[model samples]
Target: MTDVSKIFAPGGVLSQTIDGFQPRPAQQQMASAIAAMNDDAGVLVVEAETGTGKTFAYLAPALLAKTDDGERKKVIVSTGTKNLQEQLFHRDLPRIRDALAPDAIVALLKGRSNYLCIQRMDQFISQPIKHDPAVALQLQQQSRVVKYWANQTRSGDLGELTELAEDAIILPQITSTADNCLGRDCPAYADCYLVKARQEALEADVVVVNHHLFFADAVLKDTGFGELIPHADLVIFDEAHQVPDIASQYFSESISTRQLQDLAQDMRLLYGTELKDLRQLSTVADQLDKCGRDLRLQFARDPERGNWREQMRRAQVIEDSERLADTLDRAQAIAKAALGRNKVLDQCYERLVLLKARWQQLTNTQRSGYSFWYETTPRQLSVHQTPLSVAEKFTSYMLAQQMQWVFTSATLAVNGSFKHFTDRLGLGSAQTLVLPSPFDFAKQAMLFLPRYLPAASDPTMAASFAAIAKQLIAHNHGGTFLLFTSYRMLNQVAAILQEQESSDRLILVQGRTSKRELLDQFVDAGDAILLGTSSFWEGVDVRGDALRLVMIDKLPFAAPDDPLLQARIEDCRLRGQNPFQDVQIPQAVISLKQGAGRLIRDALDTGVLVVCDNRLVQKEYGQTFLASLPAMSRTRDIAQVTEFLSKD
Candidate 1:
């Protein structure tokens, strides 16, 4: 086998083939550790700090891994987001592959919904939409565009249609869900894009996917045509800090009004085409649809997530939910009556049974060790029964697979310890490593804890944050990221800055456009103040002069009232653990690390991180948060921050 160290050394294949490749001891160490683990089958949790070149470190070892018989080892690399998944598959993987093994086969597979279902699209085109005339016309035009693209697309991945809006109305109509997909029974089975992708993944030595799809497969084992992970010799999770929450989400059971609505719409479609003789199908389907919408109306119009146990205490909520259950029973009865008449209707019946069971489970607040919560959008409501901790479940699943597992992220350990992350996922026995970032942080960056800022909870906090931001933006002349823990604070500061900043300075806020577009605009403008919330905290990279200042509004703590957090707190209390120290502080520390990591992306990058919250200095637990961050020069003076920016 090729030496992993040689591949990452100064005079290595990577240095010779890849542009601007610099040798880093930490990167080589990480690659060597992973290569060593490839010979064994157990869990390894690594915290490869930002600028550690972790992607290449992990990729090199995986690309060269071999089985006992000298065959290439099968590996699955899962990322935290689709954007990173694409970046790895299309950009990073190819570079590593070319440098190490050009003949290696790799495949990128996303969730089933990302691929266009030809059967669903054909069904949609055959039927006329019953929406408002203007809306219907718009959807018709979008569908026409999709049809044209479908004819030309080989992958049928909707991401390839960059021209289409992410939230296009026609998307749900054309995509397939586990509940709606007919699988091998469909007319378009031979030309299915999802199946083709899975086939390629099955044959490839490396398969790249996102965390959501990975967990979906772990839970459902239905996302892939054949199970994808079980066949792999190794599995790696990047951005592994996100794994616990995402794994918990997949392990939970959820029932949504949109799902119920979709089932109704599908039944209605079947009634018009396949099972026209069943006149009662349309009535029950419409009733189910109305009940789902009526249940949604019982909740607040504003989008929010709340404890479902509390929600069910309301008489209107109970009454509406019971009505929904009754409607489901009627729909299931109708579906059962026409079971043998059509395969699609039979599938609908099976889906109805599962939905009914899930509804019952979600409504049962008596269940221990689970958090019952409901989230609402403008048009739908989804109730979930999430396990308080996925530690046992995840560990058992990992053990069952018996594959070499690696969990890595820039922000996994808290205060130089991996206990917080490892305990959450029950990887207590896993090997651990923490590699400091390759960048010289003390010289390249300054941590600014602005003095005399209002408390994070103060009503006037936004005003103080705006003042500090104004000062920093004036010093930096744009190229700033004012990251916030809450949208409320973000909007308030954005409003204040808009009124104060000069016309030539571009100010871009989140939610006005897609994250990708916002980032692209920020990079192109070279000097723009971008205000964003949680989404911009991490997985964002803007090296060089485009981003020289990052001001965090507050510590990125999970909201106290959040259902999952509340449940976890209660459970911790029962176990006689300090939820504040063990749970809240550690989670916040990791989050703060992620937010701070956005500043110094490269060794050549110099920046000032202005944390507007004074808690870092005033609170007793502040030292824990401080110890976890990079070794940067710290100050409480605004002048020092300005001076640092002036150097740029």
Candidate 2:
């Protein structure tokens, strides 16, 4: 911090307002790592504790290197959630700039989904309406957000627009895509938000982007990473666990029917009242409509409403998606040759070709447990297929990178070893380090497992859950987070507690409200209980003792039904590896860490994380769960938990 202190000395490079926010030791180490990496390049893994000022550790280096004028260099920081992305862009990043270089330029970048494409919005608004209130609310909300965009938004990034529904159609409405962007020639080109945001990021010294977009830039669409990396000196990945997954997504292929429909809709909209393009576009749309109807007529149920694999009639649907994209690609060539220099026509043609190419890739690509499939309902549709084993490719990307690579999270190591995740990402011999949290976890938190609770297979798991919820929460009777892996289990837990015991206060479930709203209620609980899923796992913060008990129903394993997991596991087996040990357990360890992390959010936060699964004692893998967690004191006794809460 002496170096940081000098930087803040009288008329120092860093400004006066940020003088008080000196670098903590962890922050300095992070900064030092980035600085060293500017000239050096093995790999760095940082385990920054919560109060360790990790944000500043990386941000300061990105800022300092920019002091030299006109180099066109930057640092890319990727976080895991939109909330964290927002916090950094709107809060932390600005504070660091004020403390270090008040005049520095910065910007936040997100995926296309988070921005509004006014051209797309106009098309949706003009179309015939849907009757659902949520749908209506989403459309109306999109209009309001775009209205906000014209003035307060320069880049038109929706993260700048604070108020909107999570499911709003408006967000998807406004963002540009490879399918719809007319480049510099579209009617909305001057007003295009996505392009504008990217333009600004190209000029800014520090760019705050998410892992998805960062990896997408680095791999899938090489042009995106090219915009900054050619000039960038360093890159920081926060919530780095998500990096491997994001990298895999970009390096691999995905194509969907919904992708076709969206592009088709855009073409029709751009074509407008012109009867020729409409006739052509509508022909494609009608074909897709028939595909949906055929699948529905055969299955008699929407694939999305339940298990899609049960709908054996999808072979035709998959074939049709490929045929449609290919047919459109041919039509696009004719249109491009005939239309010649017309900007809108050229864009429509390019979009048609791109859509077709992606769809073709989806249909042809084959991997273990993978198939060309469509997820469809009368109202919703997505057509895509994904490969099971992306680990080989993910590891190659990491190993190939020339920059200093750091992967850190609260739970990277399972059972006192980082091998699980390291091996999964293909990091064979990379240097690894571990830092047990400085927090006296045993003194600040406790682990409670109900010995009497029935096993997952027991017919009375719900009843056992209610008894456990009552025991842990009834004593404190204020704030608690009941975490479950599934809506079925969450609903069961909700029913058990709501029907069997009376809290006489608000009990909010995940579906009833957004995760953000639920966390708010939990924080402000007069006697509030929040029931949430993995979305609530890591990003949540309920400080002090307001949040007292975090009851988990099962150790979160990848949903056994997920096509992605099924595909990956099969690929692992072909290589003669234990999928349970290599894939499932590591994935679950990260999730458990996220859920268990809900308890000790702040240094002062005092709560008990009750694992309803007694397997912590029964299963060998349970030891991994215990070791990955903060070093909290443990006990299976209910009496000890009750006694601990008595201090309140």
Candidate 3:
């Protein structure tokens, strides 16, 4: 340990110790690695297991590296979710600041829209919202949540409103768009949260931000990283697995049909009249809104939206989409041309053009690497595609930056090789290490793939899942995560499982009780079955046997009929890359690995990882999936599963 680490030792007055929060070996290793970066290498990729205090591990090195002035020179920490962003900003940053330098200025910087837009908010407050449902309910509320929050908030970030439901609040009414911002000249500029946060970031020794903001700053060169970075000597990235995805998005851009609709809303705000301009912008907005609704109606609507049955109409879609695409393209140009004369109008128009272009390119491409999809809500519509690789892009810009770059995640490596991600991030010859989770996998978890089951898409598969549920239900008796890829599948299986069991049980589904509350209920109950999907795959932690049986319905493969998947696979084939091995199989393997990870969260945690898909035994690629997981003994026999669960 260095002098700085010793200063934070348990007995030292300056010790940054959390009571009962014992640090891990990986934390120490990571700290050593970060320290090594000052003299040795610039990049380090670490796979910190769930129980590893990875945050502090990286933070230790980060704190040690802070210039003599403070901890906030050019440190940019990024993560996958907004929740984590708040966690670091509110919790970790303070602890680090107190332990290191009290004067260390650390600021949390999010996107522009997070801050309250006084211009937009004024429009929303004064006028009667036309089509927005959320605004309707808020108009009745005497509390005026947006106004109250706007009054108190330093950031104007709508995210701070934990009490507000996303459906109950209109984001645009409070959030500012980049183009619509009145800059420093506006009346609200003196107390602007965005400006304050920016000023803090510019002055701080440590700046905390998300991966999205970091990439946007680098690519757009818009949010002013230039002011903070050049004077700073080092940069640190946390939750670095998400960097590539965010990096690519920043490199490219998206404009959606929803922009036109927003433009109309903006016109309502700006014109403060009957929208009498030759622009017909409001009418155009109404047309775009209707066009989206009509075009979406062309698809058989799935209430859950993820359903292939409701969404997929193979031959019929191409014809309908072609005409829709051309019409959108023409409208997009009109919106853009109109924007040149009007600032707010221009933002709305540019937004539409970008969406139109994105939608057309993604679905139209037959190339390898990219995936496209049609995504929409009643008020908004967008088509987006994930880039095949951002490796070249990331490396060309940031690779040569002579500073510490740390990428740590629970899921980054596949089959013990970091190459899948390493190649993608273009971290050529960077120091790479996969720190095996200290959790005792053999004792903590058991792998189970029930004997019966058809393919995921088979009509009869739901019935088979119900029968298997009976046996698995008997084992945990109720404290189990019945994870599904489809909401309909979960609803169907939940209906079936209810018929067979007599045991007292609590059932919770995603989005019903709020994820945190549902988790609270799930954790408190003596017997519970929490049914969830994608969001639950990685984060949920029920340590020390509260969670025993992790029953995956089937191997999670990307939906074949998905517009995005279809485009990416075709694109890959054109490039001569094996879509299965290069993309699909590897991607599925990562997701499965994340789901399986829920089983063993702690050293004492023990459970059965029952992957109900028999394909693990039946197919050649099954081995690939199995090989992708952490080292744990496997068995084809149900006797082992029962024996493992039978333990008190």
Candidate 4:
């Protein structure tokens, strides 16, 4: 076995090769612990706090592992987000591989949507323009840009095109979904980027993927095309705190009005180009499109997610669903009749059948052990049937795989117990490890709970939050993050601050640009205040003076109206447990920890975490939140907070 300690020790391989290297005891311990488990087939759950150098700790073992016969071991490292996935594959992995395992072959695999679909791009380029002249011209220009780049690109990963905006409309037109992809029948199948990426992953000794792709491929394995992720002897999950929710999403059965509409559009396109003689195809396609729209209209105008079981009880919902099913049956019949005429049509027929079955499954509320929920946008709606608990299914898969599993994250345990996470994932028997952050939190950070703040539920809370934010930003000069629980509150506070902006310090809002762009602007403009919601709370690292204050407007609690939370609460009650204590508090504690973790990211970093919620000090359950946080100096007086910030 390779000596991991030698690589992580003072003046070791990493230190000698990498600049600004400091030896951390916690990081070395974590690496050694993980290296010791590479020989066995058991689960290891680790809560390595911030600054633990967890990325290198896990990567070193996986890259250096060898089988009993002395062959290199295969490993899969899954991250919580695409950004992190790319970082690990493109930046971190190469550094570690060069230092220790220079021969290790590594690959990065993302979901199919991330890669450009050549067949779809060809179809999109050839399609006639039916939009307004100006709109058509814009699309034509965009298509030409994509065409030019497509010819020169090797990887065909859309992320390579940095000039294009993430929300570009041309992207959806060029990309293919599972329902629309022609698979082997596609003319571009031989050169398919997604296929090539998956093939590389299967051949590589190490593969990096995100949580969504891992679960998505797991679910797709039943369909026989889920070869995207190869079975590995060692599996490591970074940011594993996000696994339960992401796993639940994949395990659930869902059908969306957008998908139905897309099917109808595909049928119409086929009728226009391939099968001009199929008049019934166009008729049923139009009917299906109208039925989907009608069903969406039956829901409220404002976008929301609610209990699908309750919606099914309404007459209008039931009526529209029946009409949709009838239209789908008609479309399927037409598709079946023309199956032999076109491969795309045959695939469409199969999709119709699967979609109809999923629709039935989602509408059936009588099934126990599942939560039926529905969410709506301005023009689309999707229904889901999610299992209340993924523990049994997840556990069975882990046991059957017989691979050494490692789950590591900074925010997995709550109040020093892993029960909440372990129970949710059925990993109670797994060995657990918690390594405190190497940073001196007491000396580098302060927890400020402002006094006389409006309650989180009060209508004037946003105004009060804005007032406190103004004070903090004034003292800090603008290196501040005002995190909110909702967009409404964020916007309200943003408006109030905008009206009072008189300083040279810039104020950046979330929606004005992409997250990456916003962060860049905030960091570049050293004195800037950024107001954001959920996405800014975690997976954000701005060490040093760029970010010195993080003020959370409220405790990071799941909304009570959330259909999944409600379902879980009711299920807990039925099982004779305190849902508030068992489910809600733990979940909130994890979220709070994630939010607070934004502060003091490095040993030299210093910041003040100002949680505006008074409940942190006034309520009995507040102690749980406090205990889960880092051991920082506590203060309730605004004078202390301002004095601390002024010291910098």
State the C-alpha lDDT per candidate: 0.88, 0.67, 0.67, 0.88
Q: What would the per-residue lDDT of candidate 4 be over residues 1-648, giving only the tens digit for each residue?
A: 779988899989899987787888888988888888844578889999999999999998888888899998999999999899998898999988998888889999988888999998888878763889887887888888788889999999988888777777788788988888888788998999988988999899999999999998777652325457999999999999999889988888888888988888888898899989998998998898898899999888999999888899999989998888888888888898788888888888988999888877887788898989999999899999888888888988887788999999999999999999998888988889999998899999999998898889899998888888788778885489999999999999999999986887989999999999999999999879999999999999998899999999999899998877776687777779999999999999999999999988898999899898989889999999999999999999888888889886
Report the Cα lDDT for residue 224, model 1.
24
> Between the candidate structures 2 and 4, which one is better when assessed by lDDT?
4
Residue 535, candidate 3: Cα error in Å is: 0.9
Tens-digit lDDT track of model 3 for 1-648:
345445434564244355555545666666677666754237788887676777776665565564445433366676777778888879876776677556656777777767767766775667755656665666546237667776787666778777677555467666666545656545677777777778877776566777776676676533222322232456666656566556756665444555545655665554455335645555455565666555566544442223222333466555545655665666666666565666555655555565566566645546445554456565444555556566777887764565567788887777777776776678877788777677777666667766766877788887887777667668764378888988888888877777766777877778777888988998899468888888899766688656887888888997776554454466567768888876677768888988988878777777887787878889999998998787676776887777777787
Predict model 3's lDDT versus the native.
Answer: 0.67
Worst 10 residues of 1 by lDDT: 221-230
Cα lDDT tens digits for candidate 1, 356-423? 88888888788789889999999989999988888899988877877999999999988889988888
Name the TM-score of candidate 2: 0.86
What is the C-alpha local distance difference test score of candidate 2?
0.67
Clashing pairs in 2: 116-174, 117-174, 117-175, 256-383, 257-383, 442-633
Better of 1 and 2 by lDDT: 1
C-alpha RMSD of candidate 1: 1.5
Each candidate's TM vs. the true structure? 0.97, 0.86, 0.84, 0.97
Cα RMSD, each candidate: 1.5, 4.3, 4.7, 1.6
